[model samples]
Target: MGGELTWGLPVILYLFLAGVGAGVGTVSASVLLRGGGGGFGGDHFRLARIGALLSPLPVIVGTTLIVFELGQPSRAFNLFKVINLSPMNIGSWLLLVFICTSVLYALAFLPSFMPEMKHLSDRLERVRRGFAWVNVPMGIGVAVYTGVMLGAMPSRPLWNSPILALLFLISALSTGVAAIILLRAIFRRKSADPATEQGYHQSAYLLTASDVMLIGFELMVIFLFIMFAHLTIGNMKYAVSIILPGGDMAMMFWVWVVLIGLLLPGLAELAYVLPRLLYHRHYAAPVAVEVLVSIGVLIGGFMLRYVIVVAGQVTGPMGI
Candidate 1:
C-alpha cells in the first residue's frame, strides 16, 4: 500500500470543526425553541442570545479552513455551477445552504444584546422565527451531510459506513451542547437568576448525558463498521486494517480516536450521571464533570475525522 501523506490534516480538521460549529449552532437553536417555562429554568432568551452570537464564528472558520484544504479554492465554484446528484455536488449545495441559514440565525440572535437595536432586533427575531422553520432542517442536513460525504465514498473502506453520517450528526449536536454549557459557565455571572443558573446547569447536565449516550452509540456503530469492513473479502478489508494498532495511523486510531476521543468522555459522563443517582444538590460535582466530559468529547470528535481521513488514503486498494 502506498500514497502521499497529505490528505490527512485537512479532511480530519474539516470534519471535526464543521461538526463542532454546526452542533453548537443547532443546540443554541434548540435551547431557544425550548426556553422559557417549557424546559429548564433561566433567562432562556439571554442564554440563547449568547449562544447565537458565538455559534457561527466556529462554523464560518471551519468552512473557510475546509475550502482551503480542497486545494484550489477557485475550483470549488464548479460545485454550484452544476446541479449533478453527486455527493460532492450535494454537499457543496448543502454546506452553502447551511452556512447562509446559520449566518442568518446567528445574526438574528444579536438584537437582544443592544438597547438601541431592540426594536429592530424584535423584527429580525420575527424574521428569524420564520427562518428557523427552514434552518432546523438545513442544520440537520449539514450535520448529516458531514457523515454522508464520507459514507458516499465507496472506494474508501473507512468512509463506507452508512452510520457515519449519523455519527457525525450526533457529534455535532454533542459538541454544540457542550459549547453552550461552557459558555454559560464562563458568562451569566452578572445578572443570572439563581433558578436560571441552576436550570442551565441541569439542562447542560442532561444534554451532556444525552451526548454521552449518543457517543456510545456512535462508538458501537464504529466498532461494527470496522468489523464489517475487516470481515469483507478484498481491498475493503485490506484498507480497514491499515489503522489497526500497528498499522500506519495506529497511534491516531487507538490512542486519539478510541481512548481519548470515545472512552474517556464516556467514563467522565458516567462519573457525573452516577452521582446524580445517589443524591441531589450534587450540582458542583456534576457540573464540573460535565465540563471535563465536554472537553474529552470535543477531542474525540477531532480524532474521528483525523483517523478516517488519514487512514483512507494510506492503504492500497487492496493488500498488495
Candidate 2:
C-alpha cells in the first residue's frame, strides 16, 4: 500500500460521471416509453425532459477526461479502429454510440423549448421513440461496462467479483435518479393551476419512490459484494477485510457509501413516501430535504468510486 496511487481522481470522476450519464439516459428513456402517446412535454413528462436534456454532457465530459488521462488525445480513436470482445473495445464503441444517440434523443425534445422546431420535431416522433429504446440498453451497457472494466483485472482481487458489475449498475441508477431529483428540486416551478401542481407532485413522488427502490437494490448488491469477497479464499478475503469494520477503508466505505449514500437518503425518502403509498397522504416533500438527500446520494456515489478505485490499487498486483 503506497501513499501515491496509480489511477487518481480523474479516473474516479470518469467512472462516476459515466455511470450518472448512463443512468440518466436509461431513466429518461424508460420514462418516455412509459408515457406512451403522451410525448415529451407538459407536467407529466417534465422528468423525462430533465433527463433527456441532462444525460449527455456528463458522459461527454467524462470521456474527455479519460482521453486526457491517456496523455494522447488520439489514443482514444485506437479503440474504435478494431472490433473485439474486450471490455475496453466494447465500452469504447458503446460509449460512442450512446453519446450520439443520447444527443439525438435530447434533440427530439427541443420542440418543447424551441417552437420553430415543432414541425420537424413532430415528424421525428417515431425516430425519437426508436432512440429511447436504443438508449435503455446502451445506457445499461455503459453502466455495466464500468464495473466489468475493473473486474476484468484479476490481479486486482478487490474488483474481480462477478457481483461488482451489478453493484455499479444499481449505484449508477440510484445516483442518476438523485441527479434528476436534485435538478427538479432546484429548478422546479410552482404551477398556479391546481391540476398541474398535482401533476408535478406526482412526478416528484414517482422519482422519489423509484430512487428508494434503487437504493434498496444497491444496498443488497453491496452486501452481496462483501459476502462474495468474504466467502472467497486468499487475496480476495484479505482485500474485503480492508473495508470491513476496523479495516483500512472501514470508515470511508461504511460511513460514506452505506450510511450517507444509501441509508439516510433511503430512510428520508421512505418516511415521505410511506404516507403517500399507504395512508393516501399528500406526497409533497420540502425542497430543502430533496436537495440534501440528492446531494448526499451524489456525494456517496463519488466516494464509492473513490474507495473502490483506490482500494483495488492499494490491495493488489497480488503476488504474481
Candidate 3:
C-alpha cells in the first residue's frame, strides 16, 4: 500500500453516480409500469417521470468521468475489441448498453414536457416501458457492478465481501428514492388541486416509508459486511478493523455513514410517518424536514462509497 492507486476518486464518483442513476432509473421504470397505462403525461406519472428524466444525467456524467480517468478516451472503445469474462470488459459493455437504453428511456418521456412531441411520445410509451424492462435489470447490474468491481480486487480484503454487491445495490436504491422524494418535494410544493395535493401527500408518505425499509435493509447488509470481515482471518479481519469502534476510519464510518446516512433518515421518516399511520392524521411532514433527510441520505451515500474506497486502498495486503 505504498504507490498511488490506479483507481481513485474518479472511480469512486463513477460508482456513486452510476448507483444513483441505476436506483432511480429502476424506480422510475417501476413507477411507469405501474402507472396503469396512463402513458407518460398522466399526473400519476409525474414523480416517476422525474426519476426517468434524471436517470441518464448522472450516469452520463459518471461515464464521462470514467472516460477521463481512462486518460486516453479511445481506450474505452477498445473494450469492445474483445469479449472475455473480466469485470472491466463486462462492465464496459453493461454500461454501454445501459447508457443507450437509458437515453431512449429518458427521451421517450420528452412528450411529458414538450407538447410538440405528444403524438410521438404517446406511441413511445410502450417502447419506453419496454426499455424499462431492460433498464431496471441493467440499472441493477450497474449498481452491483460497482461493488463487484471492488470485490474483484482480490488483494483488497475490505472489498472482498460478497455482501459488498448487495450493500451497494441497496444503497443505490435508497439514494435513488431519496433523490426523487427530494425533487418532488421541491417541485410539487403545494398542488393547486386538493385531490392532487392529497395524492402527493400519500405518495410522499409511501415513498418515505419505502426509503425507511431500504435504509433498514442497507443497515443489515452493512452489519453483515462488517461482521463477515471481522469474523474472518488475517487481512480480512485487519481490513474490517479499520472501521471498527477505535479503528482509523471508525469515526467517519459511524458518524457519517451510519448516523447521518442510514439512521437519521430512518428516524426522521418514522417520526413523521408513524404518527400519521397511528393517529390517522392528514398532514404531510414539513418540506424542509423531508428535504433535509433526502440531502442527508445522498450525502451519506457518497460518504459510504468514499470511506469504502479510501479505506480499502489504505488497509490492503500490507505490501501492495
Candidate 4:
C-alpha cells in the first residue's frame, strides 16, 4: 500500500502547535486570574500578562495553516456545513472553541495595563472568568482529541491506543506550562524590578516543577506502550517494528524524537530536581538551560505527533 496517512505533516504539525497554544494560553489565563494582590500588581504578574498575550498567536496561525492545507480554500465551508462524531469533526469544533476562548482570555488581560480598556476590561474579566472554566476542559479535550483523531482508526495499528490521547493531553499541558516559564524567565532578566525578578523566578520554578512531573509521566507511558505493543503477537505487535528494536523510522523515533525531544528536557528537569531531593541541593539553572528545556519540550511535543502520524501511515495497511 502507498505510504499515505489520512493526516499529513501540515495537519499533524498544526495539531501539535494548536494544542501547545491552547494549553499554554489557558494556563497563562488561569495564572493571571489566580494571582491576587501581589499577582498582577507585581513584576511577576507582568510575565503572566505576557504569557497570556503571546501564547494564543501560534494557535491562531496554526489554525490558519490547517485551512491552507486544502487544495481549494473556498470548499472549507463544507466542513462547517457538516458535523459528526468523527475525530476530525470533533477536532475542528474544538479548535473553533479554543480560538475564541483564547482571544477573549488575552483581551481580558489588556485592562491590567491598557488604560483605554480599563472600563470594559472589568466586565471582560468576569466574562473571562466564565471562559476560564470553559478553557480548562476545552483545552484538555482538544489535546486528547488530536491523538484520538489518529487513534480512532483500528486499521492503523500504530495509532490505536487508549494511551495516545493521554500522551497528547499531557504533552499539551507540559508545553503550555513550559512556554509560561520560559517567557517569564526571559522577561524577568530584561526587567528592572527586584520584586518582579523574585516573582518571575518564583513563578518559573513553580511552573517548571509542574512540567517536570508531567514529562516524567509521558516518558513512562512511552515505555509501557512500546512494551505492550512488542509483547502482543499480532498486527498491533508488528506496528511496534517502526520504532522498537529496529525499523525504518527507528532513528527518527529514537534519537530526535526520544533523546533530544524527551530525554534532554527530562534530564534537564532531573538535573534541576535531583540535587535538591537527595542532597538538599539546589541550583538556579542559567537562562540558557531554561531556554533549552523549553525548546526541547516544544520539539519533543511536536515530534511525538509527527512520529505517531507518519509512522502509523508508513506501515502496511493491516498486513492484509
Best-fitting candidate, scored by TM-score: 2
lDDT of 2 at 307: 93
RMSD of 2: 1.6
lDDT scores of the candidates, listed in order? 0.70, 0.89, 0.86, 0.75
lDDT per residue for candidate 1 within 118-175, as digits (tens), equals: 6787667666566556666777777888788777766676777787787788777777
Decide which is better by TM-score, 2 or 4.
2
Most lDDT-accurate candidate: 2
Rank order (by TM-score, best first): 2, 3, 4, 1
Better of 2 and 3 by TM-score: 2
> Residue 220's C-alpha lDDT in candidate 3?
95
Model 1 spans with C-alpha error above 4 angstroms: 35-43, 115-125, 188-193, 277-282, 285-291
* Model 4 Cα lDDT, one tens digit per residue, 1-320: 26456679788878788878877866765665575413335534565567668767878888888888888877876777789999888888887887887777777778878667667766665666676677777778778888898789878887787788888888888888777767755664456876655565566665777788888888888887788877878877888788875787788778877898778888888788667557865446678888888888888888888887888887744545
RMSD in order of candidates: 3.1, 1.6, 2.0, 2.7
Q: Name the lDDT of candidate 4.
A: 0.75
Off by over 4 Å in 3: 1-3, 35-37, 40-43, 114-119, 276-280, 318-320
Clashes of each: 5, 0, 1, 0
Q: Native-vs-model 1 lDDT? A: 0.70
